[model samples]
Structures are given as C-alpha cells and as structure tokens.
Target: MAAKVLVAYGSTNGSTARIARTVAETLRRDGIEAEALPAPSVAAVTPFDAVVVGGGLYAGRWHKDARRFVRRHRRSLAGRPLWFFSSGPLDGSASERDIPPVAAVRRMMTRLDVTGHATFGGRLEEGAKGRVARMIVHSGKGGDFRDFPAIEAWADRIAKELDNRSGGGSR
Candidate 1:
C-alpha cells in the first residue's frame, strides 16, 4: 500500500506552517500521499500511516495548540510512526548555542513512543505579533534563520523511512 503521511504544525508567524507544507510537498514529489494541515484541523489521525508534528517555539515552549493536539490523539499516534520537531531559533544563534530540546517536549517524546524528533532554526521579523515576540525582535536577534537544505534533507530521510516502513523499498 502507498504510504499516506500527515504533516501538521502549530505556527505563530507562519514559519512552521510553511515548513510543514514544504515537507508535505517533498513527500508528495517522492510518490507518497501527504498533506500539510494545521494541527487544529486534524480532528483524528487514523487516516494517515505516518505523522510529522511540528510547532513554533514561544518563550521557550511549543505552541499550546500543538501540544494539545498530541495530547488529544496520543493513543492513536502510538500505533503509527510519529515524529516531532520544534522550530524557533533567532538568526542561527539559538542553534549555534546548542540549545537543548524543550523540557516538556523531551518528556512527552518519551511517553509518546515517537519514532524520532528534530529541531530546526526559525525565522523572525521585526514587527512580529505578540509582546514576547516584539521584545525578542527588538533585542536584535531577528532574521530568517531557517535552513531550507536541512529541512529538505530531513524530509528526504522521512520519505525513505516511510518507504521502508511500508515495505516499498529495500533498506
């Protein structure tokens, strides 16, 4: 059977959503059925064979909606391959500093029995909405730090993994 993948994200300034769409597109290009949807739209997850959940980091925490989505559907998620990612790094510095995964996410990842998790740099604009965002932007650590090549590479890995999992490719 062709593997169907769902790429869902919680985004504040649209960066994570764009990343999710790109990942979905990459999977589709590789002949997989994939869709990118906001976390809120995914009322259920059983339709997809695999899932990639991501969200923007805010004040050192993931968007509440993303966490809640996982919490709401963790039972179903456990029966499938699942991956998590966090996007929030200002201008490469956060990545360069070797920032660790969010504390809550680390615990959740263990409990969810997810396949894997990754972290990526994020984009920031000067006038980004929200008080915390504004303060961070005004602090002079703002720019498009996202690395497309890395994101694409990650997607490729995911596609290959899904292919292997679906019994469609030789490992």
Candidate 2:
C-alpha cells in the first residue's frame, strides 16, 4: 500500500495554507497519498505514515495553531517521520538562501526529531485579517513572495524520502 502523508498548516492570511496544498499536490503527483488540512482541524496524526507541519511566521514566532498542534501531538509525532516548514518572509531572502526555523520551532523539531525543515516566502495581500496586515498591504509592502517551483521541489524530496522508507522505488 502507498504511504499516506499529511500536510497540515496554520495560516493567518491563507498564504501558508495555499503552500501546504501545493506541497500535498506535489506529493500526490509523485505517487504518494497525501492531503492538506488546517492544523486545528486535525484531530489526530496517528493515521498518517508521515506528517509535514507548516505555519506562517508572525513576530518571529510560528502561528499559534501550529505550535499547539505540535504540543498536542508530540508523542505521536515523535514516533513517526516528521518535517516542518515556515512561510513568513515577505522578501526574496527565502528564495535566495536557507532560512532557519524560529527558536520555538527548532525546539519542537529537536523534541520530535523532525527529519527536515524549510522556510518559504510569504504573502500578505488585501483583505488580510489583522490591522498590521492591512497596514503592510496599504504601505505596499504586502505581496506574494512564494516560490511555487521551490515548494514543489521540497515536496518532491519528501515524497522520495517516504518512498525509500516504504521500500517503494522512486516514481
């Protein structure tokens, strides 16, 4: 049977959610069974063979829902193959080079023994929720900076790793 993967995310402005969907779609295209869902919506992580958790960064911290999810599922997560991702940089720096996870995320990763992590560009467009978001958008600093190709490549790598672990040949 194909390995099942879950890509769960906590997105404030919906950008990270879209990125999580892209990752899930890429994994599906690579022959893995994958789905993306909001972090708070997931009741358990036990059903997935592997899990990728992502969140939008705000004020140098991960989205609250993501943090809570990891805390809530730490035991189950520690026993499974796990990865993490953050989407929050509003500039091209993420695409240009590696950006480490925030301090809290790093601590969780250590506790969970996560397999990998990535930082992708973020987006803050009009109609975003918070006052700060609206200010940024009005100031013309809000725009989509996500690199879809890079996101797909990262997801593809995860699929390959899962395939190897499942003893399935590369797709």
Candidate 3:
C-alpha cells in the first residue's frame, strides 16, 4: 500500500498553512498520498502512516492549537513516525540567538518522540494583524525570507523516510 501522510499545521495569519500545503504537494510529487489540514481539522490519526505537524511561531511560541493537537495525540504520535516544524525566525536573529520557540519545539519533540524537527523562516506583512500581533510583527524585522528549496528538500527527506518505513517506495 502507498504511504499516507498527514501535513497538519496551525496558522494565525495563514503563512504556516502555505508552508504545510507546499510540503504536502512536494510529497505528492514524490508519490506519497498526503493530506494538508489545519490542526483542528484533524479528527483521526488512524488513517495516516506518517505525520508532519507544523505551526507558526508568534511571540516566541507556537500556535496553541498545534501544541494541543500534538499533546492530545501524544500516544498515537509516539508510536507512529512523526516530524515537527515551525515557521518563524524570518529575521534570522531567532535562529542565531536560540529563541524560545526553537527550544520549546526541541523539548516537545523529545517528549513526543518525533523523528525530526525543523525551523523555517516565516513572513511578516504590514497592517495584516491586530494591535498586539502587529506590534509583534513590527517589533521584529519584517521580510518574506522563506526558502522554498529548503522546504522542498525537507519534504523529500520525509518522503524518503516514509518510503523506507513502508518497505521501499510505493506499497
């Protein structure tokens, strides 16, 4: 059987959603059947052979919904192959200085037994959020620094791992 992959993401302003969709699309191109859905939309985990959980970072934290989703499915997640990613650190300072979100993701991955975790640069738009969110966006450097090539490469790695787990490529 072909491997089933779930690309679950949480986004407050939609950037992370785009990243998740791109990953699912890349996986599909690699011959895996993948589904990209918001974390809240994921009602069941039994159908997927592998899971990729992603979220956006805000104020040095991930979307609460995404964290809850993983925590809720902790046991199932521990048994199945899993990957975690967060889209943030567009300014590079966070990545350079070791931000809290990165640390939090590492802790969560260790606790959940995820196979891997990655951080990707995220975008910031002017006038696209509320006062606080806008302030957070503004206080940090603004830019669309996401690296599509890196994203695709990461997705390819996930596809390969799933292929190996499923006894080489297609089922």
Q: Candidate 1: lDDT over CA atoms? A: 0.85
Q: What TM-score would you give candidate 2 relative to the actual structure?
A: 0.98
For TM-score, the strongest prediction is 2
**Model 1: lDDT of residue 107:** 83
Instruction: In model 3, state the lDDT of residue 77.
Output: 82
| TM per prediction | 0.92, 0.98, 0.88
Q: Give the true-structure RMSD of model 3.
A: 2.8
Q: State the lDDT of candidate 1 residue by residue for 1-171, as single tens digits.
A: 888999989998888888898889988988889999999989899999999999899888998878988999889988788888889887675445555569988888889887877788898887688887888789887778887777777788999998888788953
10 residues in a row with least lDDT, candidate 3: 92-101
Residue-wise C-alpha lDDT for candidate 3, range 4-100, written one tens digit per residue: 9999999877879989999999999999999999999898888898899998987778888789888888877878899988887767653454333
What TM-score number comes out for model 1?
0.92
How far residue 121's Cα lies from its native spot in candidate 3, in Å, is: 0.2
Worst 10 residues of 1 by lDDT: 92-101
Better of 1 and 2 by TM-score: 2
| Every model: Cα RMSD to truth | 1.8, 0.8, 2.8
